[model samples]
Target chain A: MQTVAHAVIAAAGLGSRLGLGRPKCLVEVAGKPILEYQFDLLAQVPDVRLVVGYMEHEVIDTAFQLRRDITIVRNPAFRTTTTQQSYWLGGLHIEEPCLYLDGDIIFERRTFQTFLSCAEANAPLIGITEAKTEQAVFVAAEPDPRTGFLAVTGFSRTDRSLWEWANIACLPAGLLKENGGDVFTRLSRHLPLRAQPVECFEVDTEADLELAKAYVTRLHGAGTQVAAA
Target chain B: MKPNTAFCFDLDGTVTRREVLPIIAAELGLAEEIGFLTQMTIKGQIPFEMSFRLRCRLLAEIDVATVAKIVEQVPVDPAIAAFLGEHREQCFLVTGNLDVWIARLAARLGCRVFSSTAVVRSDGRLGPLTSVLRKSTPIRELRGQYDRVVVIGEGQNDMPMFEEADIGVAYGGVHAPAREVIENSEYVVAKGETLCRLLLTL
Candidate 1:
């Protein structure tokens, strides 16, 4: 198993659905920008890339202040594309296994680290969490008889399952297409991928924002005494 | 294997951490005055050749040695300097700046450099500009020697360099690149480390 060092964060979306008038990564939860949290966890990652589009300056300014060494790839067509496109554009031509995640969500620190650990050993892995968001593409996964870890069987919006696509994965380069249904749709081609569980709060609506705030507040209040990611 | 690629860098803001001229102006308390014109030149508000002559005249009030001293002291982008040090043979510094002003700085990287030349009067004062460097001249000159040429710059003056290269990268390490330069480039990179990484893997 190869070690993982590269990571791409799709922070280009307009966040029109969230009605924040800003990119989701800038959304402040518990008085801190979500990007700050993402950077704090990604401090160990050597090569981190961001695809910026909507209010790119704001994102770039905030990103540079966090880490001066990060690589920024622009998504000029961000208005028309999805996060999948941002993922492809951000990770352009860098041929290696890269950890991919959306900027609209918050993950438990310990669990996210565990997922990265699993990703290093598993290579191509899917991250799933218990269904908790308002709108989600549910994931159907089953235990791989050999490894005993759940493997992502399929993703469907209509299907109900205990698992939901966390929109996080460690994948080989060139697997993503510039125009794809979504991250899961592209990952679906390589089925039965190993699935690792993580605790995440994905912000899509006003309600989800409240949930994320409370989640972070709880984490801060409890410290490491709480459940692991 | 990647093709033989020549990396061309604009000296002022792209390679240095700050615009070179302003630092020289600061010595004579003309930083703000020269800084304004530098910004205008970068945005294409002033024709590069005309502005170069005018700035040269304004900065000529200072002795030639002082000008060189100021430019040499300007901080460089550490990551980019390291990249140039490692690939000096393939790396080239292309600048619209005068050669005399940047010679010491260029020697530090140990790379081939192209710049506008100027004369020095017998009294040790700077003379008039001998010629102004056209941004794309080096790209054309290096085309036969290398399989590909990649240009990096941050101002409107770099538009031609962007057009001539196989790939152009708009750099924004010091400040946001000119909008047109960003549009002309195949990629827009914000951090020096990112720019160096892209150079390594591109």
Candidate 2:
């Protein structure tokens, strides 16, 4: 069982790029909202918070139906803020290690479970994936001598790398700053963080949504193989 | 420096387990009629102040002693009651509920009350509306006394305080907050124990 007590989903973005005129978490991938998959995976986390702003009632209503126990932290300033700020607000007053992630993600169950195990084992861990988004923040990494597992060295949008940030991390609440520009930018300040492979798909744009559909289809087709390799 | 924060709470459906108005209406067998209006007001179809005025008029015929007796029995979350009791000096009940109807409930909760004031008539029934609280007045006053004022509520009427206070927490322990309240709030908490835990830490 994961020891982390809190999980916060930063779902307050306008997702203007997707142009659905709704919160991205409400955008259905196959037949369900992106939040359902996240809720299913977060069964063990005792405290869950969704930072909602853009079209929040839809998210809150859906949350009431899907998972009612989780807390709903509102970020009314979605128009002017980024995910970093939303995560900060959601994680506010949370003193323990928190599992923080983007709302628009579909992570393979087994891979995500492994990532959770690693999260508890490592302090201030970052989730990485196989460099596969449309506008990927490529992660530069090298093998850790102790475990031979990849550890993030640096992050860049222009630089090419084998792995990218999966928009997930298990971090102390104090590490997240109010003015933290982007989640990645804030994480960049404390570099050389431990990295663990978590097979996931992020839906950001119209094109990426199609790729996510394929990713979900792959997950359905093969239970174990479609996940972290 | 962390400011001396004051925790101001709304009464109906927030501290009290149910909406006090509808419960009072039940005394006169207008529960269904007033309950429908309450639901409508919560959904933002009927305006809160207008609905409140109309409900108060409908309920004005009931004896003030009887209304007080009914509200005295309304269930409250013990965890929240304990939280208020522990911080009575820094806590307040800022409600749009009439003082005559909910004053006893507020006193029981150990909160310095800021509610719409009213008086008993010659016949022992509540008189015409004396004042309808704007809800923001007390929050504005508290801001002068404290570095940060935190507002906790779950209704449409609570939006003014949410906007005025330094920090707004939409409490959904009893019911999901009005959409406008959530929009104005900086944080929305779902459970009373969790809310208390958060308040203790903050």
Two-chain complex of model 1, DockQ on C-alpha atoms against the true structure? 0.53
Local accuracy of candidate 2 as per-residue lDDT tens digits, B1-202 = 1338999988888888887877778777999879887888868798888888888887888899888888988999888899899888899999888888886787788779998878789999988788889988998888889888988998778888988988888888888787778878777777787678667757
For A48-149, candidate 2 gives per-residue lDDT tens digits of 889898888888889868876778887777899888988898888877889999999888888888888876524688999999888999999888987556
lDDT of each candidate versus the true structure:
0.85, 0.84
Q: Residues A153-192, candidate 1: write the lDDT tens digits.
A: 9999999999999988988888898877688888888887
Backbone clashes under 3 angstroms, per model: 1, 0
iRMS, candidate 2, in Å: value is 2.0
Off by over 4 Å in 2: A120-122, A146-149, A223-229, B1-3, B30-61, B121-124, B127-131, B173-175
**Highest-scoring model, lDDT:** 1
Best by DockQ: 1
Docking class of 2: medium
TM-score of model number 2: 0.87
Q: What DockQ number belongs to candidate 2? A: 0.50
